[model samples]
Structure formats: C-alpha cells, structure tokens
Target: MHLARGAVFSLLLATGLALPGSEGSKHHANKARSAGYALKEPPLTTPWTDKVGTEPWPEYPRPLLQRSEWKNLNGVWKYQNASGLNAVQNPPFGQALAQDVLIPSCLESGLSGVQADWALYSWFSTSFEVSSSWKGEKVLLNFGAVDYEATVFVNGKKTGFHRGGYFRFALDVTEHLVFNKQNELLVFVHDPTDDGDYVIPIGKQTLRPSHIFYTPCSGIWQTVWLEAAPVNHITQLDIDGNMNGQVNITVHSSAKDAPAEAEVTVHKDGKVLATHNGPTNKPFQFTVPSPKLWSPNSPNLYNVTVKLDKDEVESYTGFRTISRGKVDGIERPLLNGEFIFMFGTLDQGYWPDGLYTPPTREAMVYDLQVLKKLGFNMVRKHIKVEPELFYQACDELGLLVIQDMPSLRPSQSKHVENCKSVPILPDEKQQAEFTRQLDVLVNQFKSFPSIATWVIYNEGWGQITDYYPEFGLTDRVRQLDPTRLVDSTTGWHDHGAGDFSDNHHYANPQCGTPFYSADSSPFDPSRIGFQGEFGGIGNNVSIEHLWKNQAAIDSINRTYEIDTTIEAWNYRSHILLGELEEQIRLFSCSGGVWTQTTDVEGEVNGLVTYDRRLARTDEKQWQADIKALYDAAAARSNATTATL
Candidate 1:
C-alpha cells in the first residue's frame, strides 16, 4: 500500500471504525480494542476480522472525489425507533437520546449494536466540534448513501431532504453550522422494503428475507462526513475517454452562472500530458499522445485535475472502447476494438457482519482480489450499488463490471414463479421515481473505467412499461450513458432493446439432473449472445454461516436433490464444472457468468461460502478451464482480423 493509503487506514483505526491489523498498519490495531463493545450474539465473520468499537468504517468513503480536509462522521450516535404509532412526531432536534448505535452500518446489521427490526422511521443524533478553520468556507454535509429516504437537520434547522438509498447526496450546511462550537446533526430515515407491495424498486431486499432475497437495510448503510468547499464549488466532474485517444471533460458548477471557464489538466505520474480550458457544462476535448488502453490485462488510468475558479477537484479516467462484434460466427463483446470473452461470478456484495455494507475497506478489496486470482475477468454486481471505493478498487485491480439497477416490488414467490418476463404496468408516480433513480444510478457510476455494461433490468425485475415490449427504458439508459453496453434484461424475456441477448439456465437437482441446456438461437445474431446466469451447484457449508439451518437445507434439497454432506456437495460441484466447460465450448454463448461468487443467506449456490470460506470447486481446475475459453476467444479475434 502507498504511504498515503496507509496513513488513511491508520487514521480510520484510531477512530474505531476501520478494521485494524491490515499489513503495515498494526500500530493502530489496539485502538479499536480499547473502545470495548461486545457482540450481543455470536456472529459469522469473514476471514478479515477486527474488533469493531465506536465506529466500524471510518475511512474516507469517496475515493474518486476525495478532499484532504474532511471529517468522518461514522461513529457512535444516539438512535431510537421512531416507528411507534403516535411516537412523538417531529421531536425537537439536538435532544439527547437513550440508545447508541454505530453509524454507516444499518440497524438490522449485527455490527450496528442495535439489530432492530426494519422500522418505518428511525432517528439518529450526534454532536461534533467545528474547528476554527471552517469559518469562511461552506461545510458540505455528505452522505454516501441513506436507505429509501433521509431528512437531515443541523443545529435544529432543516438542512436537506433526500431520497433513494443507493446514490450519494450532499447539502451545503454552512449556514446551519454553529461556528467554533459544538454542533448537532440529526437524521431521520424511513424505508418500506419494496414499498410493501413490490411497487417501489427494492432490489432483493425483503421484510421476510428468504431464499434469494436477503434482509432489509434501513437507515444509513454507507458513510457520512463533512467537507469544506467554496460556496460555488465544482459539483460534478464527468469524464468520457475513447480508444481514439480523445477525452471529453464536463465540469458542473454549483450554480449555473457561477463559473464561466474551467481548466482541465491530464497527467501521468505527475508529468503533464495535455491541458484544455473550456466553459463549464460544455465538453472540453483533449488527446493523449499514444494513449494506453485499459483492459483486464492492462488497466491504465491517466490522472486528471480540474480547476474551476477557486474550487479544484482531482479524478482519473481510462481510455477504452466497447461494442458488440462477431467472433468465430458467434456474437461477442469487444473491448478496446478487440473481440474478448467475459467470464465472471455474480457478486451480490452482501456480508454476514455488515449485511449491505462490507466490514472494512480491505474486505471490499479482498472480494475483487479473490475473483481476479480465480482468473475471472468480469463481475456482474447483482442488484447492488456498492460504495465508490469498491468501484475504485475494481479500476485499480483490473476487473470489468456489469452494474445492475436494484429491482423493486414483487414478492420472492412472484419473482421465482415468473421465470418468464412479465411486463409490468407501473402507475404515473412509479414511472417518475424509477426514471429519477435510474438517472442517478447512471450519473453516479458513469466515471468508473471498470464498468463495461449498464444492465437496465435483471430478468424484468421491477420493469414497467405500458405495452408488452420494453424499449424505452433501455433507450433512456443509452442517453444517460452511451459509452457502455446496455443489457435491457438479463436472463429472460428479451425485449431486443439493448446490445446483448441474455439467457439463464439451471439444472433441476430434484430430478437428479447433471446438466440443463439453454438455446441462444432465439436471440438476434446481430447482438452479443451471453449466458448471463448458469451453473448453480448447491454446497451448503456450516450451519452458522447460513441464515437458517434445517429450513434452508431442506429448500436446497427440495430444489436440487443434493445432500448436505461435503462429499455429495463436492461431487456435484465437480460435475457442474465439467458442464460449465462443455457449455462454453458447445453453446454460442460468447460470455458466461456463474450463478454467484459467494453464498447469501439461504442460497447455497456460490463458488465460496457466505462468510467467504470453503471453496466449492477446485480452484486450479476451474481457472484452467476458464483460461482456455479466454485463449480460444483471443485466437478467434486474431484470425478474423487477419482475414479482414
């Protein structure tokens, strides 16, 4: 790790939020242990374990747009259930509360200290000392994410109101701050998982959380902090780099008339490569001489610095291109103008300790590291928008991402039963909210170079349109981000809207089946043919690691006829691997994604156990088979280019 990165980790440990004992940062390991808070119940933990104290995730949350002078607000805060009927509506802010809970981790999580049920409302209050340094500048209150809805108040004044749990938002709290004194910050949150009837886009969260659906995450599940910025600072920085060496930069000022011109400098290792000056909101184009393209093998990113009047922001971008192309008579996804095959596991991004959040920053990076070590080039982030640091880790570690918009509504029973896509007719209000949330999702993650595709919907999960065909939603995503490929729907009910035809196949273990085949012939050959999901071989590990023991085991047994014993599990996994290899060779699926990377709650169909233990398949053999698929794809690309 870099010295600066180590320093950040050390600081987080000192605050009792970050896990200690990371390599090169053991000096701060005892810091968390000193704070002393025992777990209420014995919990299943990942290999990376550290005693969480007052705060469990204290590191700077947003690495893409980081400010040196910022204060992490993730620590102990007074919390109380505001869901009780007639429970003191609109209570006075800044008042002391009885219960204490950890910030950033959701209330339902084991690490939060308050593993309360999913409530209609909850209140969080904390006090902080403002330094003399933040007098003149604006103190922007930033929340990495808040589930469903959040109403924030500072010093007894309403500072901001925000909706959507997956996207980051900020408020200029400069006016509400009590200068050089103790200030009070309070947040009220509410989340009705799936709007109680599958009307809202809930994305795998359920009140009863069973099978594929997991626990509901309400309240602040991500980081919250404060930063000093100018009154009219740069609000957003959008960067788009192409394989032709041209990069376009768009700077968004806080106010429309605030800044006329902004300067953008592109550099490599502190040396200036190119510079361009242009007006805000307009694309300023620059070119890097002999730009190094980003791919799974070589992920190169040029450092970028934007100066808009008094405010300056730092970012990075990689020069790459993506499209649908033909390889060996099969439609394939092309990266940087070359046909390449993608093989990855579906990463649900759920943890036993943190639930929706990772236990620590290192925990986030470890998941990607394991995937890369297993020789997979891509990961489909299934129905979850991870913290910015997760995406940044993917960029630095060289893993491609297919981001899915979290789905809403429909019971787990309905989703499981409706294997075919059922076109949903959403009301007017649902349409507006869905459009807004999708726009936020695209804009928030558009800058990451690792993201290769924007999945509009997953198997028509939470999809809504007036008519049978769903073309408008995919078109909206294209308009929001045209740089990446868009999968209209993955697995079932192809609308023929996006650039790929996706399929999902699973062997019925109940019939003692070894393999189930899927035909991609129904899809248009002009588009990329992808096996978005397949190969779910069940292997239930220990009882403690899963959500439920007998019930989950029985469910798996009923569905896939596989016994709970280790030997039986390993035998099926062996068979599944051979079937996977055969599918890659025989089918026209240019890309394939296994059922999952890790087991979740009731789902035992993952490469690794839920607590990230016990690999189901032999790692060496699996990697060799996947590598052969990649080698064949590359050879086809080379032969076709030579013929051209």
Candidate 2:
C-alpha cells in the first residue's frame, strides 16, 4: 500500500509502527516515496562533503598502479528503482529513467541524491565514447566494488558479471563497444544484505539498527571507470622486502604471447637505487644500496616502475621485518627485529553522508592522519575491507594494520548476547561460500607492507567453533601467506590455534588475563598477548554534532553515558589508561586497541564527534599518555618473567 502524505504519513511517524522485517519495511519505504513525501534532511555531513561537486572523486582511483590516460567516469547517471517479480531481468533499454544518482555513491547515501532506504534491484544507464587516440586498444571497464552482484551491458550486448562485493573487478568490453560514436552502457544490480531469501557477509549492518550497528549501503559504493590497455598489459604487482634490503618483485601480466619480457626499476627521492630485467609472471629479486629502514618515525618508501612489452605500470614498496620471539622469557611481537609496542584504535570506516564510501579522499585520510598525530603506531581495521588507497595511506604514513576478513552471520538483536563469545556454526553451503570469499580477500590484499597481522575470525561471529581447528581455516591462512601473523579467533572461543592470545573487556579491563585455549590452559608465557578491544567511554556532544537521522537519535537517547562534558570524559579516560598500565604487568600485554577511532551512528563513544567537527579530548594530553604507555610497555618487555 502506497502511503499518502500529510495526515496519513504523520500518523505512522508518530506511532512508530514500522513494517516487520527488512524486506517489508524497504518495500513500504519505496512505496511511500512513490506517493510523494519529501526526503528527510541529511543528519550530518563531513567537512569535505560540500567540496564534492559534479565529479566527486575525480582523482585517479588506482593509486598503487596508475596509467597515464584512462577516463574517469564518476558523475551523474540516470537511475530507476524496480523491485517487482522480474525487475532484474527486464532492462529499460532506450527508455528514459525517472531519477538521477551520482555514480560511485551508494543508494542510501545523501551524496547520491537518492537517499533510498533500500534498493534490491535497480538499473543505471549512461553513455560514453572510446578515446579517439586509442584505435585498436582493448577498452577495459572497471568497478572498485558493487554491493553484492552486477551485470554489465554495452550497446545492448552482455559483457560480464561479478559476484563478490569487497574487491575490484574488470571486463574487456572491446568486442561490445561502438567506437566512433557515443556508446550506451547499462548496469543491473542486486544486493540482498539482509532483506531477501539469502544472506551474505554483513559487518554490523541492520534494518532496525541499534546503537552500534548501522544501516547498510546498497548498490555501487565505490569508483567506476574505463581504461585503455594494450593486448599484453601488466595485471598485478606483488612486492616484498626484508631487513637487509633484499627486495623481491613479481609482475603478473595478461601475456597472450608466452614468456613476455619485462623490466623493473627502483627509486628513492627520484634517484635510481636498483634495477632488474626479467620475464613476466615470475619472481624477480634485486637489492637497494644502504637501505634506510621504514619505521613509524622515518616512513621510508621506494618507488618502483615495471615494463612488460608494450605495457608499463608504476608501484611502490617498503622494507621492514616482523617476527615474534622471547624478549626476556616472555614472547612478544618485534618490528624490525626489535620490540615496539603496538598502540591503536579500532577503525570502522563509516561516514554519515556517504555511508560505506567516504565523502572525499581527504576526509578518509584525515582519520589516519589524526591518529598518527595523536601518537598511535597501528590500527586494527575491523571487519570491513577498505579500498586499496586506504592501505597505501597506511604504508606511506608508517601505520601498522591488523586487517580483518569480513564475516557472514545471522541477524543481531538490541544488544550483543553472550559477550560475543559464542559462534553459530554454518552448514555446508554457507561454509563453502565463506571460504570462497576468504580466498578472494587474501589473494587481493597480501602485498601491502603495512599489514602486520591477518585476523581470520572476530568475536566468534562466523566461526564453526567446534570444528575450527579441524576445519583448517588457520592452516589455510598460514599456507596462503606465511609472512604475517595469523589470529584464529580474536576475542573468545580460542581453540588452541593461531599466534597471539587476545581478549576483550569493557569499563575496567585489568580484572584478569585470558587463557590461550578453551580448556582454560594456564597462561603460556611463551606466547604473545593483546587486549583486542577495550575502553568504550562515551562523551555526549551537542545535537548539531550528532547524526541527524531519527533512528540514530533514538539510539543515542537509549545508550548515551554519564560523561556528558569534555572535562569529565578526560578524567574518566585518564583513570582508564591507568588501569591498562597495570594490565601490562599480567600476561605481558604488548598492545591495546581503544574501542574506536571516532563516533559512528549512535555509538557516542569516540575521541571526536561524528561529523569530526568537534574533538572531545586534548590532543597533547593523548600524545603524552600514549608515550607514557609505550615507556611502560618497553619496561615490561625487559622483565625476565610475568605473572599469569
């Protein structure tokens, strides 16, 4: 039933009578819009949202591997919503679309100009022309990501299809292009985050969101563009290095001509350091002279250029070593073969205006820059997989990352039950799909030097706890990438696997130490430990700083804490860090991750406000406290023994 405006809609709004589940509620929302009710004003926008003009992310999307002359197709496109029986199959080929949505922005984002509640099936159409200079080059269409699934049509011919939602994919559309004249391009997308008959990996997304979980972003949420490439082009670059500056490089290429010849060059400060000539699709080794090691203080990086036949791509890498061993009888992780305590905050990567997509690149980089300025050396990028540039920023800024694999799970309630210590085992099909997704995630992200650890599962969200070790996920990850540390289970349900022993606690966390196994084995002094998550202190800001959405406001009303003023919150945080300082004595705790980097949705527990317009803490004080914590950690590492 379509809802009419004025009295009828006002009654529904006043009574808070929403439809049952996600499917019914979203269909109702679309119907309500069709009957003519103006969109609600955006709750809050970032500092960079206003700067996003016609072409929001005009900068080249691929930072690590860049080409000279690819077209950036990020602007307004004609769109239409269709959710009936066969909507996905029916293409509105030459027909006019009723609405406009900004490409690269998700359906629910205000920046898209649609702000839809949900769109399970939708159509997007646009027109473009092949560059005149490229007469016979292959036209490649690329998408950084499309929510769940997408099918592409160029000039009324099916080009390709993709399923995974967290990585990049491309298609060769040379066969379908019209070349000299304007070519028509159409896309059909389907995303069943939590509404349809099937479910996928959802990182804290919900239809009726609570304080922490938030509304999901649907449809295209990243950059999309077209590139011209030669027949034999370089596809990927994998670069790795060690303490002695022995750099290893591998060039993956689309070599129709087998054994394509290639060349690799290394540079620092625009001066040549080393060079190597080799064949495509094989490892090539070289050495940098008198290497200046990469660290949080120095952040040294070396630029690299690769050429394969008629193709060339530029990239970068850094030199460092990460390992774990007994420092003085207690095991601890060492960076550059030396003990350096890892300190960071949990970053969720959510935005008020763009949802999954950041308002702009500058806004996205600001979070990492702020944390670095506050004296943090690391961050645990929880659950969600970010775009490649995020990792590039970490590599350049000298911030270590503990990356997480996105989890597939069931629906959530008002609060997390069981302290998030239990796992709901999936059946054979779900388990298989999970493994497939995990494979794609690891294969795409293994080359970055900033990633120090890979978390296989978090808080038992998607683990088959009883059969975890037997299932061989830990073993699989170990085989996939043997260079980095693996975390089998982050918070709980530790089944005697992985490298580190981790736990989570709130309010006062120094109460006790976590055991390494589920059978409660005595603390193993030979293993490293970390406080994966802790200290969720809340500091309430004024309404202008809070997210303006009604659902978020309601959650804030229900979950906001007593530290209402900045002075009170600072005192509370000071006392909490004092507790953590004491925790360093037990289990040889080498690191701590504060609950989050910034306020997200209605979770008013951040050092800064949701809009990033207000900082609730003194920056200098945070830096000093962090320095003192590192001092204490250094002292702890020197101890000959520690109490369990």
Candidate 3:
C-alpha cells in the first residue's frame, strides 16, 4: 500500500513504456533518468483475486502431490514479446499486440498488462477447451515458477524444457491434447537480467539501481496452469522425520514399471492415527504417539493421506528436529529438544505492487501473519523461494524457516578485483542449470517440517574463486537434504564446510567467536557461531516507495538526509533496539536473524514497512524488547540445566 515516488514515476512516464525493443526506442536519453528507478514488473492478479472470473490461481497448486480431478489453467492469456527463433515461431495471433495478460502475473506487473519491459524472451499463447471432465485424463502441465528458462508447446509439438528459475515444473500434456477442440498452449521464456550468468539470486536486483540493489526480476515470474492426472499418479512426496520420533515416507511415481502402492494416513483431530501400507519404492516407517513438536511455538500439523489405488492424495506433516547442540558450553541451535533461540526476519518477499508475486493468497498469508504478529519466531527466507502456499503458511503459522538458495553469486570486495564470481565450476556445464535448480529446490522443499536451515552461500553470491577450497558446495548440500541444516556460506568467505560459524555484520551486531566460556562445562565443539547478517535500519517510508528516481531521490535526499521528526523515528527505533539488545546478550548467542522483515526495494533497513503497512519498531515496545530477549535466553537455558 506504500507506492508514491511521484506517483510511480508518473505511471511509468505515462506508459510510453520503453526498453524492450528498438532498444526501447534507444533508452530515450536515459528515460527521464531511468524513471526514478525500481523497475521489475510482471504478476497480474491471481494469487487468488477475490474469487470468480479470470479464475485466479484457484488453489490446488500441488499440495505435495495432491490430485482431485483437476483443470484450472488460470485465465486470460495471449502475451507477446518475442526476440528471435522466428518470433517464437510465428506468433502475432489475433493481432492486438498488447493488453490482456494475466496467467500467473509477470510482464513487469501492474497486473502484467505488458508493463515496461524486462523481458528476455516471451510468448505465452493460450486457448483452452478440453474439460469434458478432462476427457481421458493425463494432461498435467503445472509451473508455479519460471524465471530463468522454460519452453513448452502443444499442438505445435515441443513438450518440455524447464531449466530452473526457482523450481516446480511438470508436463504431460497427454500426448498433446486436441480432444474436444481448441488446443494451442505455447510458452517460451528465457530470463538473464543481471548478466551474472544465471543461478539467479540477484536479490535486491540491479542493472544499475542503487544501495542494496533493486528491481531486475525477469520473465514469467511464477504460476502457469493446466492439470489432469491419472494413468498412475502421485509423482512425488518424501517426508523424513527424526530426533528419535521416527517417520519416513517416500512415494514417487510416473510409472517406472508401475506396480506401486502406498497408503500411509495419519491425522489428528480429524481422526486416523496410523495406517501404513507399503511399496511405492520403499521407505515407510511411522511413530508419533506424543509427537506434537514443531516450533516457533507449537505449529503441530499431521493430516497426510497418500493412498494410491483409487488415486488419492492430501498432505501435511510436521514433527521437527533440527540439530547441532551443546547450549551453555556453546555450539547452539537445537529445536525440538531445546536450545531454541532463533529469533527472526530477513524475509525479502518483496512487492511494492507485486514484484515477486504476492498480491494475494491473503498477500501470502499477510506476510506470515505480520511476522507472527511481530513476535517473529523465525524466517530468513531472504534469497527468495516461496509459494507452496508460502511454505504452507510457514507450516500452518508457526514460522521457523531458514531456506535460502536463490543465489547466483556477486558480493565480495577487496576493492572489487574478482568482483564476486562463480562463472561455472563444480564440474561445469554451467553447473548444469544449478544442479537442475538444486534438484528442484531439494525435491520441492525436502519434506518441510518448517525447514530448519539450508543457506549455501549468500555474501559470496555465486562464489567460485580459486575454487573456494575445492568447493564441495556444502557437500553438495549434504547430498541433498541429509535432512536440513547447511549454512555453507552466509557471509564473508569461510570454506570450512557446512553447519554454523557464519557471520555478517552491518549497522553493527557482533559475535565473532565464543560458543561458551564460564568455566565451560559445555559449548565448544569447534566454535560454532552465527550473526549471519546484522541490522540495516534505513527507514524511507515511500519516496515512491523508492526503487529510485527524482535524481535518484535527489541523490538519496542529498546524501542520507538526517533531519528526522516523529521524534527522530522514535529515537532511531530506540537506538536500534538497544543495539539489537546488546547483540542478543553476547556470549554464546545461539540466535540472531534480523537485517530485514520489510522495506525492500531501496532496502530501507526494514523492521516492517514496504506494505506490510509500516511498523519500524513499537509493536508494543518491540514486543517488550522481544520478551526480554526471550527472557535472557531462558535464563541461559536455566543456568545450563542447573549445572548438570
């Protein structure tokens, strides 16, 4: 709701909308100085826009292998932006070159009516009509994301091509359907904005935006449609719970010698406790009897169905564990079985008016219920990755998630030489589309139990330099989820593989070393630390919710204006909340997330403000100074468990 930098640059210079073609009319002399910056648009409604017509993303976006006789295929589509490959093989269709663009927003958004260009390659044709009850199933097609690359065609051949933008890709098109008439459904995207050679995590983007990057998101920014399945279903689901609570369930199929069976079940106040049937390619254990645990204050979820025979699928599960222990004697983080001190925020799920899509789905569950009503239990989503109903609303509103990986690298400096690299290594082939989009983001979020951690370079962006100590990219992300917790690199350059000891301080917040010490009878398994990015605190509150413009906001209001009122924004938010509560009481600080939670675009530091409708501090005195730093880390975990 905060967009006013002289009215969105006079509505993008009264839509003369340049820079997408004839070199956007040769950047009309730096288009009014890049029309006050912040430009990346494409996301036209449908995040479930007030039900009815233009069928908004009508739910059912694969809730972990679900299928209830489908056929949504969003609505109103027929875009155009071609640049070679023969204008996407001849497509000027029904003329009108512009207007009517809504299938899963993105065309530089404003509900994507082809807003000022950021397109690299585009052509999203459409024409539906096969739903005589999905005449003989198997259609499929889903793509809840498509930033980097995509290509699909039907009724003109070429069926699939996905190359990681942010995961999720499916295609079956039942032998190119043409059944009860009207077919055609072409698609072809190719983003590469930021020329960083892909693996895109150009967070706070920038072709040339300023201070903490801004704009630059490109091509097909999430959600596409079409569905119909059966001919043997449930193509994926892999849950794995432990911390001695036991729960492993794997079920994947697209008919690899068919003959698969699974039945699982496990609900809670909707009955059923245990069911379990086997063979869907192994692994199936169960046990919960007293297992509610899932944190950020009891998230508790269960309700999983699975069944395959008459093709049934419903999902939800949470048991939580996240490890690395030793509390008072240092080390840290250990959810389910204690030492829990992960206070949060660094979200970066931007949107001045839907930038990385989120105009609804209750504005992505009201930005995780306003960071759990500003008491934030956790969320370091930063390098962007959402929609799975935003981690199923952070596993049904209990938060706790670290999950990064949207990085491609760039951010290191010793006066710029090697200015942040990663131009392919790790057995290149362009790191095979970032290992096939990090194995479709670790198989659609490794059975999310409110993800615990999985950072993998941020601060080193795409890394690589002299093969950063023979990069075993955090042992290739612990061989893809040896069940969460892998912070390979969060800040600086520390190539000492995986698990904590990460650091990044700004606007100052420290904890460089010290896991434990007070006649240490615990803590200190090779010094585990993590500040992993500190405070930023900028506070602009709409300079056209600045991405930039107005002589770059009069050169950042004449170089960082300091005149302040409203009692100096509450004494600089109570002196940056007492210097982040003394860096969360020094010593063996096991938690500290901050560096964000709103105010994106020109990165105005944020503690809410870029349309989560303001809150730069004072949510009841920052929730009584974050409940007195969680009661001094619960009195140092009860005086280290009363000295054992």
lDDT of 1 by residue, 33-89 (tens): 313234434246775544555556667677657666678777777788885423335
What would the per-residue lDDT of candidate 2 be over residues 1-644, giving only the tens digit for each residue? 11111111100001111212211111010111222212224678877666655465665667767777588666677778877537757777877677877777878878878888767787887777776787678788988888878888888888888886788888999888876688888888887776643546777665556677787777777888788889889887877777789887778887735887788888978789888898788877878877888877777888888887777788887888877877766667788888878888999888888878887777788888878878899999988888788888898898999988876654332234665553345568877877777777776787788888888777777666556642387788767766677766777566667877776766555322553434223334445777777778876666666776666665653443447567777788788777777767655677778877888988777776777776766766777888887877788766654565
Give me candidate 2's TM-score against the actual structure.
0.88
Q: All candidates' lDDT scores? A: 0.72, 0.73, 0.64
Model 3: per-residue Cα lDDT over 147-191, one tens digit each: 767877877888888766667888897887877787777787877
What's the C-alpha lDDT at position 208 in model 1? Answer: 72
Reference-based lDDT, residue 458, model 2: 78
What's the C-alpha lDDT at position 107 in model 1? 81
TM-score, candidate 1, is 0.88
What's the residue-level lDDT of 60 in candidate 2?
Answer: 67
Of the two candidates 2 and 3, the one with more favorable TM-score, higher being better, is: 2
Please tell me which model should have the higher TM-score, number 1 or number 3.
1
